[model samples]
Target chain A: MITVSNLKKEYGTVQALKGISFSIAEGEFYGLLGPNGAGKTTTISIMSTILEPTAGEVNIAGYDLRTNPIECKKTIGVVPQEIALYNDMSAQDNLLFWGSLYGVSKGELIKRIDEILHLFGLHERKNDKVKTYSGGMKRRINIASALLHQPKVLFMDEPTVGIDPQSRNLIFEVVEKLHQSGMTIVYTTHYMEEAERFCNRIGVIDSGQIIAQGTLDELRKSSSIKETIAIAFANLTDELFQKISLAWPEVKRFDQTIHFFTSNSKNDLAKIILNSNELGLDIVNIEIMKVNLETIFLSLTGKQLRD
Target chain B: MFQLAFKDLKLFFTDRRAMLLTFLLPVTLITLFAFAFGGIGKAKNEVKEYDLPVCDLDLTEDSKTAIAALDTDKAVHVVMVTLEQAQEDVKKGNKDCVLIFHKGFADSLLYGSPLPVELQYDEAQEIQVSMLQRALFTTLAMVPYSNRNNAQRMLNKQFDKLIGGGNEQLKAQVHAQSDSLFKSVGKGVEANPKTSSSTKIAIGSDIKMTKLVEAKEENSPGLIQAVAGTAIMMLLFSVAAIGAGLLDEKQEGTLKKLLYSPMHPNNILFGKMITANSISILQLTVMFIYATVAFGLDIFSHVPSLVLMIVVTAYACSSFGVLLASFAKTRQQVQGFSTLIVLVMSCIGGSMIPIFIMPEFMQKIAVVSVNYWSIQGFYDIFWRTLPLTDTTFLTRILVLFVIGSSLNLVALRMFKKNILQIA
Candidate 1:
């Protein structure tokens, strides 16, 4: 469990994190979803004891971050966005070194390393130098190193950025298994789908403030967006798109597809099909999607998750 | 802390290029110096030989004797030639000096007159001229005794001629008394060589015919100085190389990872210190062993002093490196800073050149450099061959230790203040 109350951080004239507050329960996967430079990493850094807050308090597993940093740090593991590994050292050596830094005994460290290597599926290349490893393998080892001490809470700051799909999927699976086994994890990412698919609860943060925090359904209900009807056409010209927009002023054009937002999808779906057929445009496919995190984020901040 | 240091050592040693440079660069430099300087300290006491061209126009016994003495002297290589040849050789710079014995030199000596010996020498070759002058003076010293003998013989012969016309018995008695008196005077003159010079010539009696103190046979000043200078320089380089690890870790983001652990930030600095110091000690030790085996440097006789200097120097160098690393933001910055500091210190501290030869102001500034103290401490043990308990030796070691500890504390403060803050 982690409690961050009114956390604030400043760098010179810039306020990286304002007085924002959030909490995570035990054995829950909490995702902090935001765009780039939305203070997600700053919050994570402050919570993990790597950075000091300008004016606030953070408690991890009953230990105060400011007063009892060492105790708090003992209960948390941090997987940084960048690969923070000694390229000259083997994966096993890196694990052992990190484990020792946490005061783990040699025999216990070796056993833990073996278990984590197997869990991350890096047991076969445990003895090879990290420099010789692929980007995905290196990322896996970076994550594995953090888990050596088996902390109660793990903080992963964009661990799947700039990696192949297989590695990203492997990491997702590992994170899911950890969460399923009753491990509390705080994951920060800019990917809306990942937050929706993996996080038990999501905190939508923008501009140093968390605008929304709840379950997927709860967030959808809170947002003003009701539904989005997407109609994909084989070919849509600017003239035809303008005619559709003129008929239904709420229709948004995106290349060969058009999005129609409405409060009652049942009525709008029939009307949009009739108008498109009259305009001589073939509707190749139609999808009626309810309000999701992306639409909610757009409605809240007027910007995409990656902006 | 120990584990961190051990990990650093493992990483450093596992890289073959780093290992080779840490051990090989100093040895190579020392070898090159050995050949360049014609063995260390050898230039100070080595006696150089000069060429002397001589012309004996008289061809008399006295001239032959003088030329023989000059030829036999160890300081000159005598070449007997014609007068024209002698002058030409000196003018052409083939020989440093030419000594000419004028005609009637033997007759002038027999009459107790000043002998004519002209010396033509090149003024530019002062050392060679000085050597030639000394050699010539030593060989010509015997001329006074020869003149004295010739004069005594002439006096005896003149007395015999004057008494030949008087009574035979009286003549014999007078001749015997005069001969006895002259023989006694000759014996007195031969008894003291210093007072035997001709009264007309005033070559001072204080001219030393040989060196007052001979160099010690066991120690080579050049080699020992070279070893000490090379050791300190290489120690700085090795410590800098080791300290670069800190910058590397910071750039790679591993430093932040380490901070995220339960360990304090000071543990990381202490770990790096241990690694750098250990490697420095190892580097200097290897250099010493190489010096002893290859150059016959007698370092074992002062083991206690040598060990003390090595420990203190290594500590100072490694601490200085850490202090530099604390302020550097990137690996290239560290490299530039380390190179600048090491080179300047080595230059002023008598590592690249002897301290005694430096300008007075630079020598005063040398005291502030850690390399100066370390090199001086090594010199006390290796060059001066002083005992471990000598005051100067002990003072150097203590000062070096204090300076190293102070730098380490300052570096630790800086690390806590700047590096630990996540900006």
Candidate 2:
């Protein structure tokens, strides 16, 4: 469990995090969903004791992060965005060093290293240097290093970025198993689908502020739009878009596709088709998508989840 | 091809470390070398004055005159000390040579017996010794000849006393004969240059050049200097490279991972220093062992002193490496700065060039560099053959320890501020 209250961070004249607050229950798979440069890494960095907040308080598993950082660090593990392993060292050696740093005994460290290597399916390459491994394999070993000490809470910041699909799936499965075993995890990523699939509760963060936060169903219920009418145009003119925008005031444009959010998709789809015909616009494709995290995020914020 | 070259050139120019290494390092080295070798605005004929210690046991006026003549030379300044003090100074490497005038030196010079002057010197300072010998020979040659007239006067007085009131003619003839012989001998050098060259003038005819502290026959001054200087200079380069490992970790993200651990930031720096120090100690030991085996450096004779010096020197050199790492922001910057600093310090501090060969001011300035103390400590153990309890040896060790401690303290503060605070 973690409690971050009114957390604020400043880098000179820029405010990275603007008094945002959130909490996670025991054994909860909490996902912080945000676009790039959305203060996700900064939040994780502060909570993991890699950085001190400009002004605020964070409590991890009943230890105040600012006051008792060592205790807090003992309770949590961090998987940084970078592959924070020594490339020149073997995976087993790297795990042994990190485990020792966390004050793990030699016997227990060796056992845990073996277990984690087996879990990541990297037992065969344990003796090989990390520099010789594939990118996905390296990412798996990076995650394995953090789990060697078996901390109560784990902070994973985009652990699956740039990895092969198989590695990503394996990581997801392993993390889900950890969650099932009652390990509270705070996962941050910009992938909306991953957040929906893995997180018990999702917090949508953008521009250093959390706009909405809840379960997938709760988030959908909270969003005003139940459906989105997506229309793709071959060549959409400003005049046609303006007219279409005037017709449906809640319309949003993403490249050549214009989306109209509404509670009744069938009615809105007919209206949009007639409007495109009246404006002499060619519609290439059209679809009515039911409410999901993407639509809910687009409804809550004007931009897509990735943007 | 041109486009590729231009791309590389642009990248090189954008890299400040590369630019500094290309432009600034060579210029700095040239300036330091130029200043140390031929000082700025110094006259071409100006020579370094060697300090020569003298213990005049005779204390007679003739001995005084001899010492004064030697002191008057522009090449050497005579420092009068007791025999014990003079021997201690030369043995401790404070002075390269000592001139000891025995108790009967004046009597021997006046009576035309064997001259009684001894030149006690350290054989390790081969160049200084040769220069001193040349200057001393020219100066002391005047002492015996200048006293020729006085020798004639005392002979006439002795003739007056021994032949008083009897055989006036015989005494006068004998006095005239002795006076004529003294005049001929005095003017014989000026009369015929070739004969004067052949005729030994007996300038301290028995002057002995005694080696104050004899070392093993296998050890030569050049060999010792080369081994110690090269060892120290290379040790610095090695430790600097090791220190740059810290910057490598920072770029590689392992440092960030370490920061996330429960260990203190200072512990990471300590770990780096310990690694560098251990490597440096091992490097120096290997170098010394090789020197002993290949060149017969006689290291086993002074093992305790060598070990102490090596440990202290390694500590100081490794501290220098860490300090350079903490000051630089990147590994490239560390490389550029360490190369510049270590090279310049070596040239100034008797590694690339002996301190005695440098100008007086540069020799004084050399003490500020870590290489100076490290090399001097090695010299104390190898060339000077100082004992473990020698004050100079202990001072060198203490100074090195202080340098290491001070640099480590500064590195700790900088590492916390520049590295940990931002990690």
Candidate 3:
């Protein structure tokens, strides 16, 4: 449903996106997994037609964003990170206004707003102003506003950034249901768990570049390391880290914990203990991690997903 | 405590809107008011000359003497116009008052017969009328004493009439006494210039003061000014706030969401203009209705003109709000800057102080403000009692339309540049 070709964005001297390309099939729940300030929002904004890329050609639902932006906008709904609601107006009023902007009929819009409000479990507080609602409730209404027109694609940028657990779970379920009902969704987030659970395909982006892109199994197969072994040291020093790096060149240090990826966890764990003893370093704890998106991300980018 | 104070100071200075409100607004207002009130320049002691249109029907020497005295007076600038022109000037608010000397004015003044001078004036110009009346009275009082030629001619004519009917001894005695008295008076006036300047000769000539446009109530001028001035000025302020609704949406993120919709971006700005104009018109209507109920304003009689003026005025004011919003980036900036602008416009535009009272330069500058055109339009309707067909009234509407449409065009460009094009 969406295709981006050599999408690059520059803000003055800073390059936000440096010639990245990706595509998402119809009805696919594609997650743009990245840390904050990694150009995730920029990519989503360009695809959603709210922003123009410095050099790019985005086609959404068979319409070029530059030449046919209105048509592109008609096919996609954007749920911005901010609440994006009128505090002085009721949720129903906000929904009605947004729906009318999309040229939705009043009667049909009323029915859609009713169903979406009920689906989000906010039918009871429809009359109250958005300012009176809690953060999670406002977030739900923020997401609900996008569904009024029933666009072919929904662009959700960090929709669950600052919400309660119950609201997050409800949102997750609603998104899963949307995907099942054949709505293509482009979700951007820093949370690996959300991307792991909901996204059929994922793109790991960092520093204005997409480092990796594939299904979960394909990403795991692409990476050279199959597992990760984490070791905590009580008295870790530059000398000890240097000694460990000499033996295992792929060792990554995060504070006192040294994480090294390998295909064999058992032999590496035994060797790490023996090597620590030989180096006269005290081990505090150790953890053997299986192959997962976090490990694959760590293996690919050499940094934590939440960094 | 020192650190906290320093941090707060830094924060306050960093907030551009707060800095503008704290420093720029007061300074700008003070300068505007000072210049307007003639407190900032050498205009403090400068005198204003009132233009008085005079229509002289009588070509007699006595009438000519009176007109020459008024024309030569430093306080009044006399403009010679026909009777029809004088009446039209006063009625159309071009001239505040007209002085007419009827055919028998010279006969009445010389023989002390019924008075034949009329001072037709617009009742709305009460403030200016008083000043004009002072100049007229002072110049007319000294007309006979100050002009020796006319006075000597009048004495000779009367003496000839008496001699033609009576004895020669009485005529000779009257002529000799009048000649000696005039020679002494002219010598005394030549000796002392202050005597001629301060001489007050009270003549019991009944100068008629006629109100050119009859109003429903005697105090309708002040009432109309209060209603119209407050309505237009306050409507500007309200519309400015309402126009800032666009900035509010931007700050709240709803504007970005709206831009994401299928509608054209210009619709957002046009929508704001329509809403603000509608509210302004409603506000003006409410004010007018209230004036009619509480202050006896005859709004029903001039409904058509009043409605047209109100609409144009509202459109102009609403466009002013949109222009302010288009220039400002945030809601705070719009609020602070608009307050300063609207207040200055109101101060100069005859909303707070009447424009006629301001300095000449300031009055010329007042036309640039939306309040001036709007208030003047209201004055034409309620005070001048002009009909919708009047050219002056139609010009006001056209000027307001031009102002509104011009501002709207500029606002659209700015809105697209500063607002819609940004991410």
| Model-by-model DockQ, in order | 0.56, 0.76, 0.77
Using DockQ as the measure, what is the rank order of every candidate, best first? 3, 2, 1
Stretches of candidate 2 off by over 4 Å are A237-251, B1-15, B38-43, B145-148, B151-207, B420-422
Chain A TM-scores, candidates in order: 0.89, 0.95, 0.93
lDDT of 2 by residue, A1-307 (tens): 7999999989889999998899999999999987777888889999988888888889999999978999999998889888988888999998999899999999999999998989999999999999999999999998988887888999999899999999999899899999999999999887777888899999988888998999999999898999988899998988778988887988888789998899998777787788798888889998888888888877777777677
Give the TM-score between model 3's chain B and the true chain B: 0.85
Worst 10 residues of 2 chain B by lDDT: B197-206
Pick by lDDT: 1 or 2, better one: 2
Model 3 C-alpha lDDT per residue in residues B328-369, reported as the tens digit of each score: 887777888888888888988888887766766888899998
Question: How well is each residue in B225-336 modelled by candidate 2, as lDDT tens digits?
Answer: 7988999899999999999999988888889999989998899999999999999999999999999899888888888999999999999999999999888888878888
As for candidate 2, its clashing pairs are none
DockQ, candidate 1, vs. native dimer? 0.56
- Provide the overall lDDT of each model, using Cα atoms, as 2-decimal numbers: 0.78, 0.86, 0.85
lDDT of model 2 at residue B16?
83
DockQ of predicted candidate 2: 0.76
Tell me the lDDT of model 1 at B190: 79
